[model samples]
Target: MTTTGTEIPGPAGLPLLGSMLDLKRDSLGTYLHAQREHGDVVRITAGPPGLRVEIYGVFSAEGAQQVLATESANFRKDNPFYEEVRQSFGNGLLTSQDTDYLRQRRLVQPLFTRRRVDGYAASITDETSAMLATWRNAPDATVDVAAETTRLTLRAVARILFGVDVESAVDVVQRSFPIIGEYTLTRGYSPANFPRSWPTPANRRATAAMDELYAECDRIIEKRRADGDAAMGEDLLTLLTHAESDEDTPLDASEVRDQVLVFLLAGHETTATSLAFALHLLARHPEEQTRAREEVVRVLADGRVPGAADLDALPYLTKVLKEAMRLYPAGPVVGRQAVAASEIDGHTIPAGATVVVAPWVTHRHPRYWDEPERFDPERFTPEREKARPRYAWFPFGGGPRACIGQHFSMLESVLALAMILQEYELEAVDVEVPVSTGITLRAAGPARCVLRPVGRGTGPA
Candidate 1:
């Protein structure tokens, strides 16, 4: 984020409060509306931080990209929001910066690389098949599509990454993840300043829950070590072990524990949420679902199962997934803190200013997209997609700080949906799915839908 001249008119950032109140209320919609009214490059003078902050939401994507990439030297990834997360997770990649981030990414990147993840694609297919078979989608048999999607992704990740069964840890992981992931609510209280050991019941429970989850991870790592199969396939744990050994800089057990914590928290949940939203969007727009089913039908030719080879053949499947992400983005926004003064589009941002670039805002900005609210996957066709700005649909973010798991996530979501489209129809029927945003957005209630078994063989050209 950069600074401006003396005449940059800003919205009414509440005195001693800043835009936090407005942000707290409706996060995405409210912020974008403010941007539309107060020009794109608006600053909120946060009284708490006592600094003039810049927002590049409805403005230019270039500004957001600059903050995330080129001009990133003046900013840090671990913002105020991350300070409270320290108790739950130590210095892991999600909140780490610079060298720590580079090291952790190097260690964790391989686990999700194309070649390695393909080795586990069969497990993904199997997991999706099993989940679909279990849900017969009767008229009254309400299913929380969000929860089920998370459960499936979690199970597949656990099995493929750490060689564990997510079923055994489902309740524990699910409950713990969302509670702690409520970053907007928890950002105000720092563990160092306002410790959860105090009387705040919700905070106390969340901290304890995170501790237990980490303890479980430690036990899993211990068992894996004891089993002494370091030569196992290029799974996450295996990659960590091998990478450290290869560099002759072995990560101690605690560090390995941290990686596991971050990887499980970051890698699995977000992808699951994206998949859930993908299904939800598909359910709402039957035409896309029909197209997906048709593609699946065409692909299952000659007993060839849906594998890595067929991953890219389903162009419509990829388009539908991308469109869903634009509507219901998983990582709604990215935040940063300035280490020094910066300037962008004539906006003056002081040092120590808190900055936010909301993808939810950019994805829906009317100036950048046509029918931004419509559920239209054709917007992503090879021809039309080129007409929009790059950041207009950055579900996985962009540039150097882009999600490292993009390949893994794209592969998992497509294959999971493909497998489902091949077997069952997940039809939404008068389901009231409320939005609950956290580390990811999930349905607050059951995504009630009628399920009908499609013949195991229908899809599109």
Candidate 2:
């Protein structure tokens, strides 16, 4: 099973394109196919033939562990893909590596501690309830669940993380974030010789969106500064502005802006996409939906809305969400460039090559998961999970660089799903929702669902 660098097998491509076109057209399919045909350590040459980047696609949990955990120190985030990310968001935790990443991570770590994020449960539930109330008033029973969750998550993250109500900013962000993400993807896959500064239409649009986003971040920072510590409430922005590291210097204006932008983009987009997929899955499987709803009803018999305290009581809901993530992880692939030559299972990876560890592929690899394509929430039960390798189901990634906001994201998602299940039952109009693989995996089209009110007794007229 082991192979040297030159012996790695891959799909042969055209003389010039070298699989770049296939990758762009259907990245997820290409990766899945490569793993299926070429084995765990598949070599994919992308971009122009003469100027291509050879990406080592790792499809097994063992390979993933090597890249993300065991030999993680030999791998760094300074890859072609993240270069595009840094151009937009700067050296925030997501894009930074080495000392910069460690320093910034330490600065923001306090804000996301379990105790701190647990306190936001009230705000999360309130926002979810408000969103449900809006759905109740709508004339059409059918709704674009993807758009609805995006709005709900944006409002919740803004109110709880930034201590500000950014309803107006949400519209701007929703429109611009996709543009930026698409641009980043394009840049990542473009020919190694291509110049990023070229004034292409996509590049121009990406620059404009980045500028607008930065301006909004600056405005929020300035408003918080003007209000002083007295107006500072119990939100992430307050923590960021006043946070001090061992070095004793607070984050400067630029650092603050980068952190805000990174958190805003990441905090809302991933959670919204995951919730949309969860609802889509539930709609397709009425039995599972009923199970989740029954749990909600049993847990909240006192008729109080679900909150942080009720999270443990709704294990099925949590399982359903976890299963959805396993199938369609928010960040389908996490990449790192090997700073030095490394060997994964005896497959020699040369220095500076991109090592891609994709949860989308690994979570579904036949060797690790049973019925990889099936939607089974029980796969996440503690007993079942214990039987699998730690890296086999890393929706939030693994290693020290794992997502910092995972705890917060889980709490927010659980609360929202519980509240929505209590109010409406979703019926899928399209059983298969198309997926778009950009910076994150998202529903490419509207996840259209007919919302039927639950036992509250108001049926769609």
TM-score, every prediction: 0.88, 0.95
lDDT of each: 0.70, 0.84
Give a tens-digit lDDT track for model 1, residues 333-421. Answer: 77777788677656766677677777777777787777787888888888777876676677787777688778878888989888777
Best lDDT among the predictions, by candidate number: 2
| lDDT string, candidate 2, 1-461, tens digits | 56766688888877777778888898888888999998888898877745777888888898898898889898888787788888877778888877777788888898889989999999899888888888876667888888888888888888875666466567668778888887787777666524657887777888899888888778877888888977668888778998878864678879987887788878888998889999999999999999999999899987688778888888998999999999989999888888888878668888888889889999899987888999999998999999998889898888888899998888999989988888888899878889988778888998988888886555562
Residue 435, model 2: Cα distance from true site in angstroms: 0.4
